[model samples]
Target: MIDISRTLNADTPTWPEDEPFSYDLTASIADTGSVNIGQFTTSCHTATHIDAPFHFNNSGLTVDQLPIDLYVGRVLVVDVTTKQRITPEDLALIDLQGVRRVILKTDTWPNGAPFPTEIPELDARLGSFFHEHGVELVGVDLPSVDPLDSKTLDTHHAFEANDIHILEGVTLDGVEAGLYHLSALPLKLEGADGSPVRAILQEI
Candidate 1:
């Protein structure tokens, strides 16, 4: 069986112009009579993470409010590398008959290198597609679905408008396009807009 899951760590790539990923061991067993501990700080958007509605809406549900079934489900892998900006028109080409969860692998997976502005982003119209098609969770290999400079965050607003779960910073390097059993769980961050997740896909 093939497994398609990203090993989420501090070294994972991040959004352009966002905080760089980092982790420091503040306490070690050899340093003193204490437990080894790591202290780190990063934007919630860093690494493979789940974006709760609170990220876009002022009073929307936070990470903890997410239902259990939101992150665990059957998923479809849709390849969209040909298009720089993923739009509804692009999605119209796919056969999403019974796809409940969808993961997108595009030119943005490796995400090239971080840039000052977002290059490849998903159009807001694609967000409506997810909402209308019964997609519960959406994952992409890119750091974000919105342009780094998108102040309006149309993609985000559109998804959150339908209470959708968005997963970003996914590394779909070796994942093939097909159906898989997906598991992408986020931290139970209290009242937070988003949280890092341990995402994996198992062959069924």
Candidate 2:
């Protein structure tokens, strides 16, 4: 299995002004004379995470309410590295066939790099295009599908309109483009807008 999840630690870059990831040992093995107990605080969107519809839509489903099947299944890793903007036209030449999930390998966010100010743009129109091709989930190796400063998340809303779910911040560097079995289940946090995921891919 190829692990796509980003390591959650103090160095993991988060959205500017958002909560940074931090872990503290609440009970050390020496102090407790037993197992080490630790606690962490982080933004749900930090690292590799799945954004529930509730993240962009107040009336939409929360992380716990999302369908389990959407997070685990056959997925396609399409390499769209170097593209400034990803639109339906850009994906038109690719064969989606029976694909239900697609993770775009943008190679924009390097591992261990600081949070980026600019990233490739994901067009909202691809939402319907993917829907037409039977895609139910879309993943990206970036923080958000929309621009970081966006107040109106058009792509998020469009994806929701087409029944497509979002998975973000996956590390896809050096991973070739191909078919794989994905397992990126979210924590069942009721009423939460999003949840960090331990995303992984296995060769099919």
Q: Please give each candidate's TM-score.
A: 0.86, 0.97
Residue-wise lDDT of candidate 2 within 1-204, one digit each (tens)? 999999999899999878999999999989988889999999999999999999888899998889999989999999999698999999999999999999999999987888999999999999999999999999999999999889999999999999999999999978999999999999999999999999999999
Whole-model lDDT values for every prediction: 0.77, 0.95
Clashing pairs in 1: none
Off by over 4 Å in 1: 1-12, 16-18, 31-34, 111-117
Name the weakest run of 10 consecutive residues (lDDT summed) in model 1: 109-118
RMSD of candidates 1 onward, in order: 2.6, 0.9
Global fold similarity of model 1 (TM-score): 0.86
Candidate 1 local lDDT, 1-204, one digit each (tens): 343444445655666556766778998999878689887777788767888888888988988998968788888988887878778888887778777889888855563344324457788777678878888778887767788777888888888776567988777776788888888888889999998877888886
